[model samples]
Target: MIHILYDRKPMLPERHKGKLMDNLIGNNLMQRSKKHFSMNRKLPRIPINRRFIAYVGDDFHFVWVLDFNYRYVTLQTTKNHHQLNLLFDAENRVFLDCRLVKTLDEKSRKGSIYLYEIINFEDALECPLSWTRTKSNKFLRKKPRNSYPVKLTG
Candidate 1:
């Protein structure tokens, strides 16, 4: 089964995963991103949902918990219209999976939004490590594969 990640309760069903993420990562980010750019540490975080609002110096704005082991955390920042992303390296204690992407904002009605859908650790690296934006552009062309194996479990 394809399980969708969330901050907590009131989880959306599998069929609504796309809408879930879209609702979770909503607009007003241009201002929120500017406020959290200098955050250097983590903090107590509430569960993520539609009404969640981020404040300045808030670590939760950028740091995302990917799993219970805390093995993966995503650091998503904004630079102008593009997003600067960094996925943590659990063993190294560093943000190694970096990316620069333009998020899809349906309300903006801008030219086709660009993004990099990071499926796994390898795809995460390939996304940002390139000198140019590879996956971001590719997403505009087509969607990337994020399906899990048949027997994988939580």
Candidate 2:
């Protein structure tokens, strides 16, 4: 992987060292790929990048739409209980996931176990792909949660 090789380079050549630039490019590549899914279904193809149309106004804010499909449309209630459909400079800013983890709490003196799914964009992007691979649905969720309906949301 060029990205991997780039990260393992030495410093000293400083600003002109090709490795640092390579790593930056690699990091960007990984960031872009975070939301990619290996969907094999005959669905309308979406572009490679991720973006959303959002509206934000100072006057009113009631609900937000994640996406719409023939079956149903997903809506998210805004923190402020106002009613208005406003579109601001918005993009895919919400994300979610489920993961198994070990923890210690007041109830569990030794340790507690639970699915540690909740995560932010950056952390979610760096997540390993090992668990995503399965014999049945290997194509789903190959990358970070992106898009609507099937995306990761708060």
By TM-score, the best candidate is 1
Instruction: Score every model by TM-score.
Output: 0.20, 0.16
Model 1 root mean square deviation, Cα atoms: 25.6
lDDT of 2 by residue, 110-150 (tens): 22222122223243344443332446766664764664465
Candidate 1's C-alpha runs over 4 A off are 1-91, 106-114, 117-120, 123-154
- Writing each residue's lDDT as its tens digit, candidate 1 over 1-154 gives 2354454567556565456666656655555677554633343332221211122322424333221112233222232222233433333433333233444434342223233323244543433322222335555676457655678589
Candidate 2 similarity to native, TM-score: 0.16
- Stretches of model 2 off by over 4 angstroms after superposition: 1-56, 59-64, 69-73, 77-80, 86-154
Per-model CA lDDT versus the true structure:
0.35, 0.37
Worst 10 residues of 1 by lDDT: 46-55
Q: How far off is residue 111 in model 2, in Å?
A: 29
